[model samples]
Target: MHELVVTPLGERRLVLRQGSSKALQLPKARFEELRTSGSSAVPQWLADAVQARWGMDVTGRPVDDVLLLREAGPYAFSRATWELNLGCDYDCVMCYLGEKRFEGLDMDGKRKLLAVMRDAGVIWLQMTGGEPLIDPDFPKAYRIAYELGMQLEILSNGSRLHKSHILNLLRTYPPTKLTLSVYGATAETYDAVTRNRGAFHRFSRGLRMAIDAGLTLDLSLIIVRGNAHEADDMRAWASSLGLPFREYANISPTIHGGAETLPSQSPEYLTNRAPFTGCPAGVTFFHADPFGRASICKVGRDPNIDLIAEGVEGLVRLGGIAESLMLRTGGCSGCKLSGTCRVCRPMAKVFQEAKAPLENYCQHGSR
Candidate 1:
C-alpha cells in the first residue's frame, strides 16, 4: 500500500494525496490531524469519506462500503432564491434579463416557493427582480420569509427602496445581505448604462437610505468591455460609502433576452474566464428558476426540468451534474481552474455554449 501524505496548498485548504489513481479530498474536520501537528485521533465526521476511498477506517472496517456510501453526501441545501420578475424599468444594455417580463412569480407562487424552500432545508432566501421593490407586495413577502425563519437578501436596482414602507422593513426584518447593482460613477455614465433618465439620483438616494437604515450592503458592478475600466471607479465609490464591492462580468448579452442588445462573447472578451475548474453546479449550489426548475445556472434555466416536479429529493439526487461538465485541454491540465470552473458555468456557456471548454467572465480575480 502507498503511504498517505499531506500538502498545505493554502491556509484554509489542505490537499491529502494517498497515491491512489484518484485523489481523496479532506476538508475542515477531515484534516484536523494535519492541523494539530499530525495528531492521530481519527475524525469521526470524515471516516466515511476516508473509508470510501481508502477502503478502511483509521482502524479497519469489515462491513460493506456501499451501505456506508448511502449514508453520506453533500451538505444540506441551505439557500433558496427567487428571480422575482423579468420586467425592468431600466434598460442597462448589459442587464441579463433585458427589459421584458419573461416570467413572473406572483404572491401565490412566492408562498408556494417559500414552503418548498423550507421543506428543502433552506434557511436563507433571496428575493430578486428586474426590481423586486416594484412588486406591490414586496414588504409582505419579505415578512413572510422572515416568519419562515429564512435570512433574506434583496437583489435589486435600489431605486424604489426610498419608500417609507420599504425603509421601515429594513428596520423591521433586515436581510442577511443586500446586493445593489451600481452601474457608473458619473450621472451620464450611470444613466447611459441603465438607460433611465434621472435614475442616477433615485438610485443614489435609495442607496444612501439603505445605508442609513443599517442594512448590510454589497455592491455589484457589471464589467462590460465598454465599462471595464470603470470597475476601479465603482470600487472606490463603494469604499467611500463604506460598502464592500464585487465585480461581475456582464453576462446579459449571452442569456436569452439580453442577447438582442449586447454582443456575444468573443475570444478577446474571454480574457476574464474563471480559472478552468469543474462545474460545481449541483454540488456547491443549485440554481432554480422562478418556477422551481433546476437550471444549470442563473443564466441557463430550462423549463423542462422543474426541480419541483422532480421534488426536493429528486433534485438533490442530481448532485453529479457539476462533475459531469468537467473537461481539460492544453495548458489548463492540472491547473486550479479544474475545480474552480464549477462556480462560473453560466458565464462559461455565454462564450462557448455549455459542455465545451470555453472562457468565463469572472476570471479577472482567482477564486
Candidate 2:
C-alpha cells in the first residue's frame, strides 16, 4: 500500500500520509504536473521533499507504489463519515439513534460502498456507529478502507478499547484520530446513565489501555442529567490524562424525531453557541449510513442516495438535496432571528418535529 495519498480537495489539493497527521499542500499546477507524471518512478524532488519533511525515505519507488492519487470528481468531497453499524454495547438513554439495531451492509456490501467513496474523492473517512469495534466484521471493513487510501478516523465509547484485537488493529493502522465519549468520572454515575452494569469499569480499563498503547485519542465529555453532578470530575479526569477534550451539553432528539432523549439534557450545562453558519454538507462532504445510503449530513438524513444500487453516480443528486434542506422555508419562513439562530434550518426542523421545547432550539425561546 502507498504511504502517501495525493487527492483533490475542491479548488486545492493535499498530500496526506496514512497513520500520520502531517499534510502538505500542493498547488493546482504542481498537482496537475504530478498527475500527468504517470506510473513512472516517484519524482526526485517529490521524494526528497517527503524525505526532508517526514524523514521517510521513499526514494527510487514507483510513483504508484509510493503515492495513491485520488482523481478530481464533480462532488468536490474530501471528507465523509460512515456509520458501519448502529449497534452499541451501551444503551445510553440519550442516544440520538433511538433503536440500537445491529443490522447493516455485509462485507461485500461494505467493500463496494468504500470503493464508491474512494472513487467519489473521499480522502478523510470517519467510521462511526453505536460502537464500531464491536462489529464482527469491523477489522475486515476497517482494513479495506485503510487499504483503499482513505485517512480513517473512529468514534467510539472506549468500552472496547481494552480488547487485544482492537488495540492491535488500531496500533498497526493508527486512525487519523480516535474520539471516545466520556459519560461520567465515577462508575456509579456512568453505569446509571448507560443503564449498563459494570460499563464504567470496562470503559475505564479500555481507556487506560488505549492511552498506554500510545494511540492518538481525544475525549468528548457528554454532559447529561444523569452525570451532571460529576461534570467537574469528568473534565479534571480528562485533563489528568493530558488528552484533548471538548464538552457536549446540548442533547438532541432521536433521529426518528422521538423526544425520548430530550430528558437527558442537562439544563445547567446548556451552552449558547454562535450563529448557524451555512455548511458544505453535500457540496464538500456527506454522511453514509450503514447500508450505504448517503445523505447530506447526520442532521439532514432525508432523501438518501443509495450508493449500493446507484453507485457513485448517485452522489450527483446530493448537492441539490443539501440546498433544498438548508432553505429558510416551512416553519422558519421569514423568521426575524434568522441571522442569529444557533441551529441550522434542518436541525431546527428535527427539533420541531420532536416538539422539543422552543428554548432548546429557537432564538425566540430565549426571550
Top-TM-score candidate index: 2
Backbone clash total, candidate 2 = 0
Model 2 TM = 0.95
lDDT of each: 0.59, 0.89
Instruction: Write the residue-wise lDDT of candidate 2 on 196-257 in tens digits.
Output: 99999999999999888888899999999999999999999999999999999998898999
Q: Rate residue 45 of model 1 by lDDT.
A: 45
Error (Å) of candidate 1 at residue 64 is 43
TM-score of each: 0.65, 0.95
Poorest stretch of ten by lDDT in candidate 1:
64-73
Per-residue alpha-carbon lDDT of candidate 1 for residues 85-179, written as tens digits (9 for 90 to 100): 66677877666664457465667866776666655655456778667787776787777766655557788888887888888987666677888
Clashes of each: 12, 0
lDDT of 2: 0.89
